[model samples]
Target: MSKHQLKAVYVISVAAELAGMHPQTLRIYERRGLVSPARTQGGNRRYSDDDIELLRRISELTDEGMNLEGIRRVMQLEDENVQLRRELEQAREIALHAIREAERAGARGGGGGDLVPLKQAVAVFGQRPSIFDRD
Candidate 1:
């Protein structure tokens, strides 16, 4: 798993302490759907580092006078923004790779893929006389 995908290990009390909030507050946030901590095999809540950061963000939004619903909406928008940014980066990377492959194919005199642009794809590839030229 990636660093961000690390399993939750911090229990509620520790997570609350790390986030500088009361344990009860953490429970409230869970009930509010603000945070979704992982559950242990025994059905216990375990918060990860990412969850701690989320708790901090919740605290910030609350401090800024945003209601729980408003904070939830803001977080949803932020999550969408992050997902779009990541997808855009992946698309850019794919485009760059395609460009590089195209360049290499051109350097090899177009001996690469089976497909080509219609504008360049004459039915007769070699020196063949057209029907117009025939009469």
Candidate 2:
């Protein structure tokens, strides 16, 4: 099966069961906008493995005496952090791909072999000269 098909997405009831919480609590969380699940064409909620994990975290936080408002803010911050991490990972992969492509091109004896020096490249881009340089 493809990676998309392998995703562990479940209905609200199933997710509630997995997280050991009542379905009504899940609905309450949804109503509070704590977790936004994917919706079907019929507007039924679909919970992914990530959503279940977040629910468990919310449960844990609440059990520790955090109010719903505090939990909501924490969840929002956590979600933002997760998104930033994913973006950083994608950027790293792109940079690695570019490095590999450059190496291949350089090995082919094309003009690509004449890559600009770091300082020269920075100068070309109008950046200040390297700090290590003597006046």
Best by lDDT: 1
Candidate 1's C-alpha runs over 4 A off are 1-6, 111-135
TM-score of each: 0.72, 0.56
Candidate 2 residues 4-74, lDDT tens each? 33464698889999988999999999899887778766788888888888899999999999999999888
Q: What is the C-alpha RMSD of each candidate to the true structure, in Å?
A: 8.4, 6.8
Assess the local accuracy of residue 120 in candidate 1 as a C-alpha lDDT between 0 and 100: 36
Give per-candidate clash totals: 0, 0
Backbone clashes in model 2, listed as residue pairs: none
Compared with the true structure, model 2 gives a TM-score of 0.56
lDDT tens digits, residue span 1-135, model 1? 445336788989999999999999999999999998887668888899999999999999999999999999999999999999999999999999998888888878887563465433245666663544533
